[model samples]
Target: MTELLKPELYAVVGTMSAPLHPSLKGGRCMACGFVFFPPQRYGCEVCGRSGDCLQSIALSGSGTLIASATVHMHSPGARPTKHGVKPLEAPFTIGTIKLDDGPTIRTIIVDANEPSLKPGQRVISKLVEVGSGACSILDLRFAPAL
Candidate 1:
């Protein structure tokens, strides 16, 4: 069975063993109508409402690429990981994406040719394997939608 890399940050559509659609774990203010990503219990930034006013929500993973950049180097030794998590190799790409649901997030972009990517291109959520121990550990990534 596969496992999500960070259950607190995102959720899978179908099942953990075979995730179909990936989405971010977010929050909405019950006091106001503020929606946010990376779910936080702290007071709402919009309404100043406390944790009680926040409700757990799932954010749409689809978005538009605002910008992208590729990292071409890595520090000397292999980076340490918790629980055998595999550190992404250098030359990986990262992108700033604005979700259709109304939040901008910076995250990894896989299966993409960085140089060819253009701003405002549609993107979709993807789960890619990052490690394997007792089970496959999958992490979230964004890719340009064809």
Candidate 2:
């Protein structure tokens, strides 16, 4: 009884897993051989191919920042901090990256705190913790290449 309860307790307090995977969500397209991230839902939206189409594929995570911009205002229903403190200056940078795997995606750049940016810079995706303890959300974010 105690062992069963311990497992349950651990689950309740454990960190949440991310939904996307580099291998499972960003690899070769089964139908067209095109690799992408946030993998295709049902069929190939680009080639219009169907049947035995789009499958979970791995992504290289390496990409070039094609374009970027900062968002100064928060959208409606945005989650506030656990301590009730809103971000002092919640500026976020969004960019479309051309991954080596052959697909482009709009992703948040975590290292966008800098005052400036340039196109064609290298970036990599990473999992980031967005909030406190149980209420946290794991999100994909990009950072400048090391």
Candidate 3:
């Protein structure tokens, strides 16, 4: 049987399922309508509200690429690693995506070469697997919208 890919960051990602769109999960402050990625649990940063006023919400997978950069050299050295989750390779593209809903998130640009992306371009979220062999981690990535 194939090993299941676990999320490296559970609070920031949703449960993975086939035929399901991959979206970055966020928290919305019910008190002030403030949306933030990587879901906050303590209190609202905008309105100083605490307790259960923060509700879990799913963000839109489609967004506009506001900023992007190509990494020529990378050293992911001395980073912590969880079981079954391996570090990704270097020289990848990373970009900031402004979701259609509200939040802006930084994500890996899948299959993108240097100088291939620009601001104001449309992109869509995708769930990808990082690492090799039997162990991998499920992660949210972005690609140009078709």
Top candidate when judged by lDDT against the true structure: 1
Index of the highest-TM-score prediction: 1
lDDT of 2 by residue, 19-88 (tens): 2322214545566676655644565766877556766554565678898888888676665544422332
1-146, model 1: which lDDT tens digit per residue?
87877888987773342245587888889988888888888889898997678988778778899999999997778674557688778998999999877789999998888988999999889888888477788888998887
How far is 18's C-alpha from truth in model 2 (Å)? 18
| Candidate 3 residue-wise lDDT, 57-116, digit = tens | 777677899999887777847342656556666778999988777888887899677487
User: Looking at model 1, which ten-residue stretch has the lowest summed lDDT?
Assistant: 12-21
**Candidate 2 vs candidate 3: which has greater lDDT?**
3
- Candidate order (lDDT): 1, 3, 2
The number of residue pairs in model 2 that clash at the backbone is: 5
Indicate the worst ten consecutive residues by lDDT in candidate 3.
10-19
Pairs clashing in candidate 1? none
Judging by lDDT, tell me the better candidate of 1 and 3: 1
Select the stronger candidate by TM-score from 2 and 3. Answer: 3
> Among all windows of ten consecutive residues in candidate 2, which has the lowest summed lDDT?
1-10
Each prediction's Cα RMSD? 3.4, 8.5, 3.7
